[model samples]
Target: MQLHDFYLSGNCYKVRLFLGLIAQPAELVNVDLPRGAQKRPEFLALNPRGQVPVLVDDGQPLVDSQAILVYLARRYADTHWHPQDAFSQGQIAGWLSLTANEIHNGVARARVGLKFGRPVDLEDAQARGRQVLELVNAHLANRSWLVGEQPTIADVAVYPYLAMAEEGGLELAPYPHLNSWIARIRALPGYVDLPRF
Candidate 1:
């Protein structure tokens, strides 16, 4: 198995974190996003969208971090990582969607601007990021995990960018529940460290 990854990407980091949590080993192929490696011909052949965190397993390449998490959860992780029940699946899918949309547009985008010198509306992005932090913080107030009793792909999916929110200039200290959740994820066995720039 192999993961075409960009070291500073939260999306790529989430995939790597899941692989670590599930004890799955994959060769990490660095795609230098800063150098435009993801847009090259060979890389485009691997992922037409030219995104990082493409997982190639058994000769099949999976694109998009959320999709990659679903694939890994079903194929390699413990049953708890992705329960088979419909309600649980639905709940998990919601969190995944949140990761793709709100988190992606908010904290993730802000990080790109603040930490990587990318262009973005920092104020608006941080505003959305704070809203996400509040929503998740409220949801997690009475629950240890996002979907069910155990840590699921939902937790893994949302953890990366949120964990790195302070880098985007959004303070994490205001949300105690969110902080607790971050601690829980970090304490999990085989948990991987957040990506560094």
Candidate 2:
């Protein structure tokens, strides 16, 4: 198995974190995102969307970090990471959608703007980031995991950007429950640290 990764990307970091938690090892192929390598024809063929965090397992290329998480969870991880029950599946899917939408647009975008010097509406992104911090903090006030009693892809999916929320200039100290949840994930066996640029 191989992963097309960008070292500074929260999206790629999530996949790497999940693989670590699951005790799976995949060759990491660093993509030169700053150099526009992702837009190259070869990379585009692997992912027409031209993004990193593409997983190639058994010669099949899986694009999109969220989709790749579902694939890896279903194919390699134990059932708990992605429960087989219909309700659990739906719940996990909803969190994945949140990761793709709310999390991406808010926290991830702010991080990209601030850390990578990208052009973005920094104020708006930070406002969105704070809102997500509040939402997740409230949700995690009495729960150890996002979906159920155990750790699932939902937790892994949401962990990366939120864990690095400070980098985006959004304070984590205000969200105590969220901080506790982050600690829980960090304490899990085989857990990995956030990516450093």
TM-score of candidate 2 relative to the true fold: 0.98
Stretches > 4 Å off in candidate 1: none
lDDT assessment of candidate 1: 0.95
lDDT of 2 by residue, 1-197 (tens): 99999988999999999999999999999999989999999999899998888999999999988898999998999999999999999999998998899889999999989899999998988999999999999999888999989999999999999999888899999999999999999999999899876
Structural similarity to truth (TM-score) of each candidate: 0.99, 0.98
Off by over 4 Å in 2: none
Q: Count the backbone clashes (under 3 Å) in each candidate.
A: 0, 0
Poorest 10 consecutive residues by lDDT, candidate 2: 188-197
lDDT of 2 at 145: 92
Candidate lDDT (C-alpha), each: 0.95, 0.92
Best by lDDT: 1
